[model samples]
Target: MILLLLILTLLSLSRGRPNSSIVNHSTQLLRRLGVKRVPFQFDPYKEGLYYTNLDQNLRQVILNARNWTQISTLSNIDFIRAHNVELGRMQQTIPASSRFPCNLSQTRSPDVASHISRLRPGDIDIVAAFGDSTIAGTGIMALGFWDLMVEYRGFAYTGDGIESWRTVLTLPNILKLYNPNLYGYAVAHSLSADVKRSRLNVAEPMLYLLDLPFQVHVLIDRLHKDPKVNIHVGPNDICSELCYWHDLEAFLRLEERQLYASFRLLRDNVPRLLINFIIQPDIDDVMNVFSEMPDDCTTKASFFCNCHGKYKQEKYYNVAKRFFDMQKSIASLPELQRDDFAIVTHEIFKNVSNLWSRNGALDKRFMANDCIHYSQLAHAVLAKLLWNNMLNQTDFTLSEARRRPFEYFLCPNADRQFLRTTGDRF
Candidate 1:
């Protein structure tokens, strides 16, 4: 009877096709080993179509037009606009809740020790700065922004504490750097870029960057502690200029889903797990610093120009605006709208970049040789801005006098040394 059943199963699998012999033999072999063939369907739902039921006239509307001005016309499509409007009306009807109480008077005081000591078992306070080289501090990791944030408690001299990538460190991991047990996490890389290649700096491919298994491997190495992750990178997404706007929009939507899944996994494993994201600096504003530099096109063979070349400043501006819009859309996502999931805005960095542009200080002095990364002075200013933003978001205030640029640097000597060493050479 068992032999007969095996023969019947083999015949069913074969269907007498050209490759029936191979199929029948494989099925019979599996049956002999008691391996049942279980058939399953892998079907995924498709994303809802936006203008599926629209009339021909409305269907002709190009919702996602290339230029910002064209996008405003009635011909442009807005799939989410309806949803956003509905949400806005609902918000008006609901009572406002203050998850973050503005405690302007409560500054970072002598009670720092108590704050550091307040961590109970299973309590997690992670500051995972995820982004491109800016968050990584690239070559500045040893003497860069992270060190500066940790060095200044009262503005004297303090040594650098734990490295940012250490997974298993102590708790009370707020802004303080001296806590030997405290942990820090970095999910950033200097060359971390956007989804396509279109005349932008191409170091790593976007598909690889977004690959689940690969990201799990990279992130797990540093983020295994299940800490609250903070992402501060996005400008690189549009660094290619005038390329991949659709790609950027799609990437963010997919990323929102991935982040929600990743955060859920962490939340299940860690206590009070949170995720924060900082909007990137306006690339157009920063690019203006490079744009105004004198063009040095000596020859037609000169393929590259260091801020001194004929480049479309408006293209960079448009891309930056679109990038900011994409970020705002992602932040407004329901999954990322939780109290634990916060978004630090772009106003502070935007202001600083604008200051540099207006003062004609966007020269080589403020940036590295590549004219991309920040100089030591620039880093100091940018770090203080970030520090202040964090302080405000957490409802921790500082007396205006305490917020000096020099106070943030842990070792100004080391920073200067690193800058000098990498100056015009990097």
Candidate 2:
């Protein structure tokens, strides 16, 4: 009887269809070990289709493909929904937003669930967001907002997550990916060391600078044509002390002029462009937190403690605040205000910092070992905040929102996720 059972198990493995009872036990073991793998790989560019791999005995697909076009043609893609099994469709799937206990989850009504189920492919919004580390979703050991959105099947364009990307670099890249025709005409240049100057030199190199007129024209035209697509530009223009209010103001002025030109070209092509900014924790508060630490708690002991050698602390703080204030002023500009163009400022981190401060020092609960970056909890909060913001926008209709609320967001809890171990790396 034991020999017969062993033979049956071997047959099951060879057939690629393990008994449901056996799969359940394996899944439980994987869940306890805190790791799970999706059953199949999906190609996002090709409308999230799945491909099948035949056993060694069968003739393999695309065995002799010489190039990408040929490989694409030969791919044995399984388009039938019944054959393309989704792991998330299982009954015991984990919640998408359950990475941390602090992360909030929404409960939708039955009506909402019905609408979500009825949502078809291409109904989801696709956003091309541009920014530095913050917009890229840099955290100690957490999923970036872009990652979360991608995992949930709400299409968000991604680039080098660690690159020191600026507006000039991002805008052209966005065009290149979205409008290849326009991108063909856009000039290509290496990023300059001086972050303040544009490589194109048509205007001040900042978020507001619209040097590539043709690219912007194509971008707006595409946005008008595709209502499901949106644009998000969050520029962290001021990184060092060299950038100031005048530079940011000048940059915004250039951006406004270009935007106006685009609007004039296509009267109804106004995009729901979100010019969003995040207000950081107060420099004064951060400095006070450092001061309260023991003498032994130097930069070596704690990355955030006594950083800048106490002498340069105030200077860094002052420079940061200068840019922060400038961003607020730009957001308030009457000329920049319009139905299609919206300026969003997030101060939740600042507010939380105040609450977390005790004895003139911030607790490390929501902060990372380095005082500047956020902790896992903070990353979860930021993900939800950004997700909610996306939902509130016109790009996310009610039907779309209903579908994405419960979708699995991959990499919710990744340990040791950051690269380069150093205080100044950030």
Number of the predicted model whose TM-score against the real structure is largest:
1
Model 1, span 1-426: residue lDDT tens:
000000000011111112334224434433543434432335332221111222222312321111122212213223322332333210111123421112222222333223222222123223333333443333221122222111111110111113221211111212333222333322112122111100011111112112222232233333332343322143444443224334445655554454344334333433333333445555555455554544431221122222222235555445446655655465445553332332323344454344444344444344433344443334444444443433333111332222233333222121221111101121
Q: lDDT of all predictions, in order shown?
A: 0.30, 0.29
Q: How high a TM-score does candidate 2 get? A: 0.35
Winning model by lDDT: 1
Model 2: worst 10 consecutive residues (lDDT sum): 1-10
Q: After superposition, how far is residue 348 of candidate 2 from its true place, in Å?
A: 2.1
TM-score between model 1 and native: 0.43
